[model samples]
Target: MATSVKSLSNKESKLIMAHMYVAFTALFVGATCGLLQTLERSGKFTLPAGIGYYQILTVHGVVLGLVLTTFFILGFMLAAQSKTTGGLNKTERTVAWIGFWLMLVGTLAAATMILLNEATVLFTFYAPLQAHVVFYLGLALVIVGTWFEGFVMFKRHARFRKENPGERTPLLSYMAVITMLMWQIASIGVAVTVLFQMVPWALGWVETIDVLLSRTLFWYFGHPLVYFWLLPAYMMWYAIMPKIIGGKIFSDSLARFTFILLLLFSIPVGFHHQLTEPGIDPFWKFIQVILTMVVVIPSMMTAFSMFATFEARGRELGAKGLFGWLKKMPWKDARFLAPFIGMLFFIPGGAGGIINASNQMNQVVHNTIWVTGHFHLTVASAVMLTFFGITYWLVPSITGRTFTKTMNKLGILQTILWTVGMLIMSTAMHWQGLLGGPRRSAYSEYVGNADTAAWGSYQIAQAVGGSILFLGMIVMIIIFVNLAFFAPKGKEEFPIAVVSNKAALPPKVFENWKLWIGVTLALILFAYTIPLIDIIQSAPPGAKGFKFW
Candidate 1:
């Protein structure tokens, strides 16, 4: 019983619009900082010493990586839940609005500190670099807000199950719940680090902090944070892409299975991010690396399923040849092209992920520009592109408008610009990384040094790519503005792909969220317990915080 576009209540529409507004505004601010960083690194532009490169970097990462992704995903999920599951009840809606405002206020507070140069610690906010107490407090509030929203979603889904005991949860709603569940579990590591470690240290309640312990906890939350960005994009791929392309989901059961596996495996693999770090046991790191490798299985399954669906649709559309089906796709549709281009970038991005997760390979590229390249490809290109694609129709749907022809054409161009920019920037970054270019540093110092001269050219390329990306972002914002405010009023359909009739529903076990949650916790404990204990036991004397900026 999907809710029609016209059926949306004013409250739901306003809430959804608020979420999107914050998300897009963050995107604009973050992308501007990103462009400045790229140019600054290339020695093409320089900021005053009062506003250091690291400060801008911190703002960029927080706004884009943490704030934008968090707000957008929650908003998107709320929209999906409303459309598919009869909208949130009054209590849930009230709570959701509260959460949104808390997150927004916290974001503003944090951004103020960053802009004031009081909090130069990067998004990881790794220890030894202490920020203003307000920064940590703001981040804590954001996380708490998200938790409140996650609770509402979980309760809503529980009520749905109670009402329809034997039926499987709707695919979109099911994925949304799994995503939030994994986030709640995965966020615990960072939450503990912030609430107990960083907050005390920042407030001067503690003289020094345990650097290793803090980092260990951060990565514990950090790696799964990738999945938090990714699963939402995957939801669109699995549940909505098929409909846009005139096909049903390949298998609803398999989609649910993939999400379940993600919940189980995503958290335990956090240690893979620590492969090159000391203090943690190499053996435990090895175990986590294997676990990280195992998580790839579900992504591979998704790839196969999506390709099969695309192929079937292509054949039905009368396309011939092995690769001709790609041509048969709705190439002119910005919604499809944006995400499809993102998928193309992910082919390399995912491969880079495998490389980064490898014990041997990670040593070569740890903390290098290659790691940046990989994440940009996945999170920036893949995840953000999909988010942009969703905005194409999502804005119009909530506003009771349709995209202008000019806006749709601009959307397509924006995607192309983004794709091209990412390829250029990421390729340059990868090559420069292999040549020993360090990440998270102002590299302009080496511009003319003969020893590091090779990196200069790539830096220039990166700047060019970044400029193009900024352009694309501006265009995207323009398109959204037009659709949201000025476009002619018309009906815009919500596209929720159907499950193929031939595909049988999974066993009831697949829908047993309680069972899967328990197994997921067990796996996380098995993977993290020993290493975390060892780190706590062997931690060196605490570090007195520094404010380098």
Candidate 2:
């Protein structure tokens, strides 16, 4: 009954599938790297001397964190756009394809350099650990491609607004546009760093790079990068999950407000990541810490809204009692179950985030495995699981195929494996971190060092967990391949939740993009401009690039 009223055109279907294909391929490569890294850290496995730990780590982070997430989000947004609004017009579709090709070429270029060991610089790409010129160039192209896609989406939204003057923009399209807009703004910092700073330095045009300045620029993009991955998951949680469970969004207005808050607060809090670094005033760090805490409010609001929606749906199903409502949900459906489990992980993930944001508390966990555990919960568990859940139905919707009932069962098992694996690995990471186990180290270096021996058991646990996670990923990839290419052809449902009765129509002001964007820019300027100026003026002499590995 929740099936899309209109089917996607052949062109739209092809565009969506193309993006998804790249994303899944990257996921496979990234997950394999992840398992390898975990085993290496546990001392159970070792790469040949030329293939170093940092090299594999860099590949894992870039492929999964950057390439996979970016490609998947673009594809998912396009699919959402087609289902919610009419599919993109011919010109828009052509633009999207161009962007996809650019991204693909860029990804391959970057991956090649990293694989060749020319760019051992980690995903953070912090200088004086410089990457090859092509690595920077390739990454720049990917960002430009995303910008093109963002522009097209913005244009489509504008046309929609012109056509439907007084109506609230369709929720999915509105959210998608906002996500892209926020990313465009957020990425400017990284873009500047790469184009003007890293590229020239890598090409020998500049002999040295200001390490602190480069790191500052990267963090400016890095913190919001989490939200870039997150907001889409939020989109599914707020707009799609409720419908999958036969309910409505608790409040459309609140959802929009939450996104607005994220856009405003997300950029200014990058300093929270750099609290331990010098060249920035403690005052500015304190300011960013407060801003980071402020950003958590919107997540809390999301939690309340999600629970309220679930409760309302339960009541409608004639369920009574507090716990009984949970049972009424469609847990059998992978589309609902996986994302809901993701939401559950977000509770802990968000808590860890708040802890990391605290200026005082951060010192204890800074650069430790604790931070790794925190992010794995957020991005790997919360955001990634939600993406997997989306594909359970989305791939079928685009391909006009049915994900077989057996495949659905396997999907559930895959989610369980991932959840259990992440819990085991992340828990060990956090505990070992608190005990002073450093992150980003080759465990072989600690062999026979009594100081680090306590970490061995935890590392072993991580390896076991990583192995299970790898299997889970393999299962997911197989399920999707079957759904896309081998499954029986049939129409699949595309769920879009309705606004709840308790929620009134959002005010026109909520749709005032100019106001929100202006406020976001103002907040960023207020928070970052002065600190950046201070950093520039007081920066130490730049350092020459190094390739220690």
Candidate 3:
């Protein structure tokens, strides 16, 4: 049940591929920095050229975590919407281009500041650890660019609905609109903090900054930011993977419901990231912690949905017994395997998230390298692998090229290397963190402290893992290039699975944007308004900015 689809026109393909170019380039540069950081942390290597470890760390975080993810998500979503809705109209395409240029310019400006050592602030850009004004401005531009892209998606979807009166909205377009909506809402917190708080302070317009307020606002965006990354991966799992595996979607209604759940829950739960911050009230933190826990529902729902999708599909292919269905899966198809492994990683990743959200458990791992390991599993592994999976087919589809069997084999090799690398690196990180290893610092002896000394072996293990992951990155970049430029010209299908006829049609109520957006806002205001007021009124003396680099 392939939903037969036409290839995107060259203009639209070019628009999307622009994002791919930036994204893969960022992957190369960011992974290099990551490898260097791991080696430096192992204490067997020293950074040359007077490069600060924090500078490279900042680049690693911002480039991979922010720039690469943001660019790829936008590009992919644009393709999704375009594919589902016939194609982007002239106006929509122009708007997307405008968005891309803004983001590219913003990335360049911020990267320059970082390379010059003027901005060592990490991706979170926590306040009082200020960077150059240009860096903050650059980030703002990037966010604004995404907003433009979001607008284009919304407009295109609206046009889709208007033309096709009673047709159920295409699943991919519906999901894209929801994802962008979540992003637009969640990003407002960071946008507010940057424009009003950090921007002024960085320009010396303010003498002191409300450290607690800045932090509170940041986590407001910070927690949802993780979902902003995860939802796209979920999109692939729900809508695209079934087609690749030659199966019908398990349940369309369930998939939409899961995404709506993420939108409602993802925004209000940011306080889970701030559980240890003293200025926030314990009661508010408790409330938000419960909200964070609610997020597990959708995550589990997704897991359940994937399981059902797989089992049903496998049984269709004549699989027998409980575990036999797993064997029926397409193991050699990198298109399926990469994202399938990503789903597997999220099982532990989601469990780790639950642990991080718990007050008692958070007390153990707060600010430790364990938190770093946690996200590496979720975003870097689960989300990234899925993106790579999407790229394998997507690049060729958009470029009017065929994905050769040779490249398919290469993609499988890439997935294996990435899975092995991440398992080794993330495990070492979690273990070292449990032993009291701190995150975000270079090699240190701490006067030959025993606990710190115990972390040495783990650091070395991390270096080895990072080296392997870098190799995986190289393989991925090679595949991307060959698919985009060197592959033989032909039409490649953009796979979108048909809904199972046994499943009930999705309810129109799910299309009620007003109800859901209103609920989301109400939840956020209820969770944040009181705690935010408390922080501002009881605020301590604001701290001036610091440039550690």
lDDT of 1 at 143: 88
Query: Candidate 1 regions off by >4 Å?
Result: 1-7, 445-453, 541-549
lDDT of 1 by residue, 137-157 (tens): 888889888998898888888
User: Tens-digit lDDT track for model 2 on 1-549?
Assistant: 333322577788889899999999999999999998999988877776667999999999999999999999999998887677777888999899889988998999999999999998988988789899999999998998998888878888888889888878888898888899889998998888898888888888768776777788889899999999999999999999998998999999999889888888888889999988977889988888898899889999999999989999999999899877898999888888899999999999999999899988888889888998998999999999999999998888778888779989999999999999999999988987776678776653443233565567788999999999999999999998998888777787877888988898887887788999999899888888888778777765554222211
lDDT of 3 at 316: 91
Give RMSD to native, each candidate: 3.3, 3.2, 3.3
What is the per-residue lDDT of model 3 for residues 270-305, given as tens digits with 9 covering 90 to 100? 888888888778999999999999999999899898
Model 3 reaches what TM-score against the true structure?
0.96
In model 1, the Cα lDDT at residue 342 comes to 88
| lDDT of model 1 at position 295 | 86
> lDDT of candidate 1?
0.87
Give the Cα lDDT of each candidate: 0.87, 0.87, 0.90
- Model 3 spans > 4 angstroms off: 1-6, 444-454, 541-549
Each model's number of backbone clashes? 0, 0, 0
Model 2 lDDT, residue 316, Cα:
91
